[model samples]
Target: MHILNIGILAHVDAGKTSLTERLLFETGVIDRLGSVDEGSTQTDSGEIERRRGITIRTAVASFTLGDLRVNLVDTPGHADFVAEVERALGVLDGAVLVLSAVEGVQPHTRVLMKTLRRLRLPTLIFVNKIDRAGARERELLADIRRRLAPSCVPVNTVTGIGGRAAVTRPVGSTQEAAEILAERDDGLLELLVEGGTPSADLVRAALAGQCGDGVTYPVLFGSAITGQGVPELLDGIGTLLPAVSRSALPDEPARGAVFAIERGPSGEKVAYLRLRAGVLRVRETVVFHRGQNATYDGRLTALSVAGAPAQREAVTGDIVRVWGVPEIRVGDHLGGPGPAGQAHFTPPGLETVVRPRVPGQEPRLHAALLALAEQDPLIGTRTLAGGDTSVLLYGEVQKEVIGETLARDFGVEADFEPSRPVYFERPAGTGEAVEEIQRHGRNTFMATVGLRVDPAPPGSGVDYRREVDLGSLPPAFHRAIEDSVHLALREGPHGRPVTDVVVTLTRTGYSAPESVAADFRGRTPVVLARALRRAGTIVYEPCHRFEAEVPLETFGAVTASLAGAGAELRDTRRRDDTWVLAGEIPAAAVHEVELRLPGLSHGEGVWWSEAAGDRAVRQSTATR
Candidate 1:
């Protein structure tokens, strides 16, 4: 059977979950349809997700249709959970981007489209919610073409009252499809010149080629709630989308990428892997390669398809859940020996301290957060010396979800303090430090080390190199020095992660027979700290990129409001009597703008913000 690993993505309230439930029911995977409001869908199994009616994480389900087996990944729609979407995209062969005919294209819709195009994934656009009272399919399509992409060509259409009926016809016979193909495809042009209609197979073949190449996108219409156009949608997926070719010999070694990580009900770590080559079997040792030639090996104790019983083996193109791999992370690649590519997730510009609501669940809270961070790296955390913990956040919604998840999944209640912008410190000028051999105080192991700190170009993270002779120190002691240097820089002179700097070892003087290797470990960090303090540092604060749509009458007020929040306007465009404003602003002021938009625009305002990296703050002000 052909396997298709496809992901479903859309903006919040775009009926993505409803469409997923409909597909499962239509394909006979479920006996009845599940409601998104009730959150009883097969993919959304978390209690918090069910109660909130929002997808907080990515979920997967499998169903069979004819000779094809489709593994569908339901990704979160809210911008707060885009990390979930990023991880999902790594394992997919194709995608279905859902758009609401009522709401048209949205900010997240554009974001997802850009990522899909960048990754060159074959995509099908589903214009959903046609049964709604305000549905305007034509206008929505035009909006998609203008704002999203021009390659969006309709594959099916809906008619009748409330669009209760739908049908699909040969792509070659339709004027729109024929014209699109004839203009670009020589074979279709020759057929048109011969006064002959292209066969369904030929048209589908051409579409698969172009769509997979990212040159075209097929648009299908439907109301997922009423099940109208659903059957046609499923048929199109099975027929129009490309399938994985099974040409690998059975003896080839198995290779896969770990795209997601989660904890099972039994407290075992589960890694969701997309097998790309050969076959994987139980008890087989899988070698994972990560950054800097790191390798982790584990025996697969069990393997299973999404929500299914354990299996002894998984073939190529299968999304399998495996156990007994505790060291596996979200981006680890197994079998084939090379570092895997990582998903480009927007960094969290805001951060806040997370404290346990109860008195002494501190360890539990940190452990829970560490587990969560392993699953979604965007939710990174920092534990201070006094045991205080802070978590990075995309927005307040994500913060709330983290607290709710800890309570629901781990049975520990937690609360977050007011969020603040995260900052980074970088070296301002070149500096040097030399530590002389000493046998007093904390320097039990006598050693002498010299280091130079230099500024690096922006975005160049901390780099360390040594220029010492190998005979002076063993490789183990050299490694200890590098590790200590990294730990010391975690909280630099300005109390933030150090970036865009190089810490190099320039000199080392220690008696080969008198120096204890462990002593260098203790002195290395101290010397690096001295060097960093002398280097002087500058602070940079996080910034966000925003886009808003406001009525022309209120554009001035909105611009003034943004300006007050330390925003730098990038561009402004007029669209259908509405002014679209784009700019960059301090992340700390985003909430104030969100709160004031409703009253400023009489509830007709829509705006969204995403992390846009960071910028150096005023020289006189310091941020920690």
Candidate 2:
């Protein structure tokens, strides 16, 4: 059977898990489909995920789709664990982007659709849960066009209304599919205008062009419940999506990165791998590394796909399980034969941070969190000194999933403290500040620093420059003191990552017959804090870039709201149907606009935001 790796992605509660169950049962892989509410889908194997009716981890299962062998990865739909989605995408040939017919385009929808487009993976939209009331196919379709790039086209239609959409191949040039093609090249447009239709060969060529440039998305309709359109959905997966030639696959070096790692029931460590350009066969010896250049060799004792051990070899585009690999980690790239090109496995952006909620189980909480983090690289969890822990996240739903997983997945209860992100304060135009230090010990390490801090443009990164004489203090004491300065500004006044800022140490004077422990330790914090106060530093604000479309009449309202949120209106343009606005706005003020913009547009709007540089250019949602 031909293998196809596909991802089921969507906004939360949009029936992504339900759709997975539907695919499993209809294919005869399961006796009966399990419900998310009932907490029994194979993909939702973790107790927390099942009880919460949400997906936090990415789970892969295999079953046949008629003539095709599909490895379906049911990804958490919430923005929280976008890491799982991004990690899973590395192994997928294409994706089935699921959506709720009732909800239409949403926040997560905008983000994932953009991601799918960027990766250039051929995508099929499965508008699920059409059987539910108020499931507006026409409205959602319109919104998709309004908010997304024009290449997204509906290839099939849902008949009989209520989400149980019937399938239709396509009729004429009037369909959305035509629009997807027309935007990419004019030859197809000419063919559509020429007569009835272009030859299938011509259309296939056009589709390829569209897919290559992220100019087209094939939209399919189906309902997971009623089993409507499931047949065509199965058939379409084989035909419309062309497989990359087997020979075309690269003969990569023996380098595999761990994207998802787990422990089997017998306490065996299993690493789920996406060969980031590599080769491995049975009994091949490889290194299990511990950070920088430290390692131990181990044979690949086992190999499998979707928990079913395989008889053959693992390849790129195949997600397989490997045994006997130790200290394997996400983002670890293994390549050899000269200087290696390190490939980073940066999963989708995270939006959730969680602290455990179980009683008297803090230590177990760290274990559970680390276990998940090892499996998914995107879940960055760090424990700071003073017993503070930090989790880098993408969104809210992921936060909840992490908490539930602590108690239910690994049997731990955790208490979450207020999250304090690393902060940075950058130069505000060479504003000068002072530092004075004296220790309580017999010899005090006193140093005065005339520092200038200037705000750098966003994304420029933190830069530290020393204007003072490097040899001013005793060699060892001076180095120790500068090190403290670096640590002092980690949590900028704003409580966020400090970026694009420059700190200059213009002057330094120190008295030091310094002792290592008492003198240096006592003076570091005092002088650092005093220096910060003297500079009168301003908080480095977070900036976001967003694309917006609204009725012409509402443009004024949109701009006004942006201004109220400390946004500088940057770009304005007109395209096929609506007006597009792009600009950089303070992240703190964005919550107001996000809540108000949809209301201003009468419930028809799309928004996506990421950290932007000092300068951001916003364009039409369909421009890309």
Candidate 3:
């Protein structure tokens, strides 16, 4: 049998979970359908998830279709949980992007579609909720084409839309389908130009091939609640999408990635691993690679592949859960190296300090936050000078969920301060510093180091280079210098994370027998810090690009609110009976603006924003 890993993605309330249930029921994987409102869906089993009716983590389930075994991954639709969606994207073969027929193209939907196209992942568009009031077809399709993609072709036609009796049927080969295919196929274009019609079989083959190549997308309309057009969707999944064949050589080494981490009932860590090659067996010790130049060996005590009988071994293309690797993290590679995981979206730009309401719970709260960070590394946690714990955040909803999770899972109640924007520091000028080995008895260390700091372009991050000969010191000593430089830069002269700078090792000297890696590690930070201080630093605040839609009557009040929140209006236009405002706003004020928008617009306003990088702040206004 073939294997295919597909992810279902959308904005919140687009019926993504509902669609998952419908797919499971249609495939006969479950005895009956489960509802998200009732919190009985198989994927959302967490107490917090059930209570909120939102997916905080990516969930995996399996079902069979003909000779194919589909490992369906259901990802959270909320923007705050976009980190989950980003991680799942690394392991998927294809994706189904769900859009609400009523909402048309939303902000998050546009973001997801942009990412899918960037990754060149084969995708299918499902315009769901067709049975709901105000649902649209022709107009929505035009909007999708204008905003999302132009290559999207409808494979089926919907009938009785916007009613409980809405349904869909396959629309055989049509002019649009032919034209879409011909856009990328020379043979098809030539046939069309010659007035020769291609057979339905030929057109279908061309469509499938192009779709798998990520050049064309097939759009299908359906109602996950009513099961309308669901059978057609099933057929599309089995026929239109590609199935991967993992036929690795018998001698091939194991290669896989850990996309998720979950704790067992007994609190042991369980890793969700997707093998791309070779085999992983029980009791076998495997090397796990975390980031660059870090590896740990752990034995697999148990293994279970999805949609298959219990076995001692799992092979390529298997989504298996393995035990005994407690040190594993999301995005870690197993066995050998593969493509480095890319960040599909900007990380959280705001952070909030969390304090235990109950005295003496600080220790437990820290530990629990650590565990949560392990699961979603993007929610970075740090300790402040006063011993408070702060966590990076995406929005207010995530903040609430974290509080709820801590109370329910760790038995600790906490209060979070108003979130503040996380800032960064950049080098202001070039500077050099040196720590010599036993020079005038001024240095105690046996190793000598010289570092130079220079400003780099924005968004370049930190770059480390060496101007000294590699033979001047052992490789271990060089590694120590590089690692310590990064660690020291974490707290720059102004106490903010430093970025967009180049640090170069300009000088090196070491005693033949007395020099050690520890000596270099201990001395390198001191030299780097001196260079940074001499260079000075400038602070920058993160910003977000925002779009606001408000009724014509409320436009004046909404604009006033935006101006009061430190926003810069870049464009303003009228869309029918509403006005659209587009601009950039400081990240710290985003939540406040969102809160005030509904009231200002009389509950008829919609707002969306995404990270727009950072801008320099005046020294007087910079947060220390």
Candidate 3 residue 24 Cα shift, in angstroms, is 0.3
Residue 51's C-alpha lDDT in candidate 3? 81
Best by lDDT: 3
What would you estimate as the lDDT of candidate 1?
Answer: 0.83
Task: Work out the TM-score per prediction.
Answer: 0.89, 0.69, 0.96
Worst 10 residues of 1 by lDDT: 161-170
TM-score of 2: 0.69
- Candidate 1, residue 500: lDDT: 81
lDDT of 1 by residue, 413-518 (tens): 9988889988889999988898888867753667788888999976667778778777667777777788888888888877788878999998776676778677
Better of 1 and 2 by TM-score: 1
Candidate 1 runs further than 4 Å off: 160-175, 178-201, 246-251, 307-310, 336-341, 426-473, 500-510, 526-538
Over the stretch 44-131, how does candidate 2's per-residue lDDT look in tens digits?
9877777888887778888865556678888987654666676677677778878877767766677788877777777777887667
Candidate ranking under TM-score, highest first, comes to: 3, 1, 2
Superior by lDDT: candidate 1 or candidate 3 = 3
lDDT against the true structure, per candidate, is 0.83, 0.64, 0.90
Candidate 1 lDDT at 386 equals 92
